[model samples]
Target: MSLKASDLKVGDTHSERLVEDLKRTQLVQYAGASGDYNPLHTDELFTVKVAGYPSVFAHGMLTMGMTGRMLTNHVGDGRLTKYGVRFTSQVWPGDTLDSTATVTGLSEVDGVKLVDLDVVTVNQNGVEVLKGYAQARID
Candidate 1:
């Protein structure tokens, strides 16, 4: 459903659990689908021995995509006009992720109602893994 400008205020928020107990298989699948096999994501041995990470970690894009799912769920399909994010931390297998979108601004530009949102995704430990912003058309 579309959001209405009149029904929203700055600081209003929507949140969703993006993933529970993330899996390595899912990371590998994302690697294959996105064609981003960089070994850091799918090769535990290389990630640990070569890259010196604790283990193979989730791709930043995968976490961003999961956060996007939350945004689309809140704002509805095809409503987004702009979206961007920054990766703040690594996400590992078995971690749970929760994403939140907070209303930052609402306005009518050239008769088109729009909403601005500040997006954040955090892990089970409450560590932010992704941060970003999005703009979307609203009713």
Candidate 2:
């Protein structure tokens, strides 16, 4: 499902629901898989009492990964040449997330077509949690 540069424009977009009612179990699993066991992510007691957050929150990387999945699903496997993001807000249990990738640029560099995308992930309330950009090879 490679994107064709000729078929895309700067404002074209693709979106996906990344998660629904995010669970603490999913946070713990991501902690184990990514080796990021910060109490802010998995320790509800510490997060509330000691860390002073409302609750254990999702890892920024977890949200970023979900956003990346949206990008890959839109751009095709192994097509990404660059990707980067900034975590804008905390994601907590029970939050549903939706991600979007909007084409920002299209060009042919050295005869290879490429597309630049602006990526964003927002929670159920429409608060952005992750924002980034990606560049990928296209058909």
> Among these predicted structures, which one has the highest lDDT?
1
Q: What is the per-residue lDDT of model 2 for residues 1-139, given as tens digits with 9 covering 90 to 100? A: 8998779999999999999999999999999999999999999999999989999999999998888899889999999999999999999999999999999999899999999999999999999999899999999
Alpha-carbon RMSD of each model: 0.7, 0.8
lDDT of 2 at 14: 98
Q: Which candidate is the best by TM-score?
A: 1
Task: Quote model 2's TM-score.
Answer: 0.97
Over 22-136, each residue of candidate 1 has an lDDT whose tens digit, in order, gives 9999999999999999999999999999899999999999999999999999999999999999999999999999999999999999999999999999999999999999999
